[model samples]
Target: MFAAWWKLGFDTTLLAFEAQSVIALRMAKLAAGGTAAQAEAQRMVSEKVLAAGEAAMQLATGASHGAVVAGYRRKVRANHRRLSRGAKAI
Candidate 1:
């Protein structure tokens, strides 16, 4: 009976350790994935900002596509207003 109890206790401890290790590994993977996703999102936002700036410059120089650029600028302004309102609410 004593040997059986000791064996059971050891087995429980080992199982607990394995569970903790698995949880730790999963958390690490999630953190890494989150960092990668954040970087990608930032890169995409930068590209969008650069494109918008180029469009604005073209509009300022009275480019032939003024109508299309004006529409895009309007859309961008609407999005900014929506985002600002949401941020203020938060």
Candidate 2:
């Protein structure tokens, strides 16, 4: 549903970002509730899960016909870079 709609130009990138953010928050929660070793393991597993999700989203969006998803991803990376630089200036 989301991937298809996103392919149709429905702000899918934001959805992906939101999903990733939620996963990060969950990772933090797990870290806070566990011993150091447990936390580390949880973090590592969480990172792998997050990375997989990100990769899938990227492939799904990037490999679409006519490069539509790829174009969007490029613009997003450019904007993120700009924002990071701006934050550094602040």
Candidate 3:
């Protein structure tokens, strides 16, 4: 149980950091006149917002921190798998 909490915190922090990096990179490209970056940046931003809202709801309802993190992990892994197959995020 302790390990689960630790992993959740660690993973959540890492995910947030990665989201910032993605946003920065996309914004840079968009600034450089890459029109396509606009959509990509928007999508990343939306994903972050969506995840935060969902996490908040889960916590409000008394979901375990570890369970919430695991839920995100599953989604991330599913996205990873889809991308590996040359697809978009699920």
Candidate 4:
């Protein structure tokens, strides 16, 4: 009876350890995924800003029509607002 009790205790401890390990692994995966998503979002914002800069340069150089420049400016402002909102969310 004593040996049986010892065996059961050992098994319970082993199972608990395994459960903790699984939980830890899941947490690590979630953290990595969040980091990757944040990086992608930042990259997208950078691209949008660069495009906006290009648009402004073209406007300054008088390379595009007034209507086109105005449209690009509007798009840039929209993107900036979106980025700001996302930042607030984070």
Question: Which candidate has the highest lDDT of all?
Answer: 3
Cα lDDT computed for each candidate against the true fold: 0.54, 0.54, 0.65, 0.56
How far residue 80's Cα lies from its native spot in candidate 1, in Å, is 46
Model 1 pairs whose backbones collide: none
Instruction: State the lDDT of candidate 3 residue by residue for 10-65, as single tens digits.
Output: 98887666545544555555565544556656766797699889999999999988
Which residue pairs does candidate 3 place in steric collision? none
* Clash list (residue pairs), candidate 4: none
Off by over 4 Å in 2: 1-34, 63-90
Tell me the tens digit of each residue's lDDT in model 2 across 1-42.
Answer: 677665656456654674454445445545555474375466
User: Distance from true position, residue 50, model 3, in Å?
Assistant: 0.6
What is candidate 1's lDDT per residue for 1-90, written digit by digit as tens? 787667656655654565455445434444556664466457547856977787777778887453434445454455445444534443
Which sections of candidate 4 miss by over 4 Å? 34-90
For residue 46, model 1's alpha carbon misses the true position, in angstroms, by 38
Of the pair 2 and 4, which is ahead by lDDT?
4
Candidate 4: residue 26 lDDT (0-100): 37
True-structure lDDT of candidate 1: 0.54
